[model samples]
Target: MTKHRVRTVERYTRRTRWYHAAVYITVLALLGTGWWLLTGREGEPSPAARLTGAADVTLHTYAGWVLTGLTAVAITLGARAARTFVVESVRVDKGDLRWFIRWPVAVVTGRFSHHRGHFDPGQRVANLVLVTLLAALVASGVGLTMVVGGPGFVWLQRVHRWATYLITPVLAGHILIAAGLLPGYRGVARAMHLGGRLRVDTARRVWPGWLDRRLAEDDKQPARAEGDSPD
Candidate 1:
């Protein structure tokens, strides 16, 4: 009998995985408390607020603070990675339009168009939109915290509310895709969780350009090492 072997690729570093976990947890907490408070439930404590012995407003405020701290830490400690993320998210490839056109069908069929980038066209657009919305939320939240009552406070509140409204659906779609609920995205959740490793074939199908570059770099290692070795 022959044994079957499967190859895997490292999709995220430990730090990146940890950072992602922190951000999502904080964001979810903020959303839950924010929504509850928004819907005339500020007088009633949420489960988390009751558990923590804090008001919903307090919990939401602290969650925002945690998110802010996390962002600062990521920026300070992972500057290069942050820059790379922004650069990759903003880049456009020649095939991106075609990829976007095919994406709707591909979601159900599990067939995607080929493009050259770290992120697919859909992912790049998602990244940009998500980041912008999150930034707006953060900035408006900070303004709300600082201002007691004025036109500025009202404006900030409007921005914060609108950002939340926009981000909720966007985040929902992101979660659906990232969770591998879509046929085309099967196995993609492993890239950020389950030890941040992905099956090589899955990575090839979803991120062919990234996989190709990674493999090319890997192929150069042996030759480079041999050249550096002393006789």
Candidate 2:
């Protein structure tokens, strides 16, 4: 295998990374619990069932609090940055037009070659949708949880149920796409664990101003006068 040396733009800061880690772990918790509940394992009085049942609900609630708190903090701390991420991921740019059109056909015809650097148009669109949908699901979920002691909390539960159900297919697609693009599940795992570096080409394409400026600065150095040059 050939290795390419490229500069990685810093896309995630420490705070951002921590927030994302919590959100992902919580999401996994929710999904695992929901799966068990749906499979009837959560209802049964078996050790695994009872354990997962209470654990999942407690986790699901606390996870909501953590995610919501982080989201609020993010918006407060970096409104412009958060807005930019949303817009960039959702906007279908010119480059994406061709990639989106060709990708499905290529996959169908067994010609789906993985490209390095940046999300293609289709992936961007899907990411945008997934983020938005999941955000809504989380919001609805937390809102529902709050009304537990009130009348019509059943309505809230129903909403949460539907939102939870909607994630199944989306989760599948998200997994499949990651699996296809990464070397293996481990590759995807590493990417998340490390807040994956953006490919140079992709980063340049997406944020030319930021990437190019840094690259140019790195490459350029002022020459010293002969008298002043280090001996």
Q: Which stretches of candidate 2 lie over 4 Å from their true place?
A: 1-11, 45-54, 105-119, 148-152, 179-195, 198-231
Give a tens-digit lDDT track for model 2, residues 1-231. 845444444444556666667766767666776666656664444443466565555655666777677678668886886787777676645454555555665544433334332354555677777677677767777777667666567776676677677776787777675544532222333233344444454444434445555566656543222223222
Model 1 weakest 10-residue run by lDDT: 222-231
Q: Which candidate ranks first by TM-score, i.e. highest? A: 1
Q: lDDT of all predictions, in order shown?
A: 0.88, 0.57
On the 0 to 100 scale, the lDDT of residue 74 in model 2 is: 62
Task: Give a tens-digit lDDT track for model 1, residues 27-143.
Answer: 999999999988999998899988999999999999999998987986898889999999999998898998999999998887899988899999999999989999999999988
In candidate 1 the C-alpha lDDT for residue 198 amounts to 79
TM-score of 1: 0.93
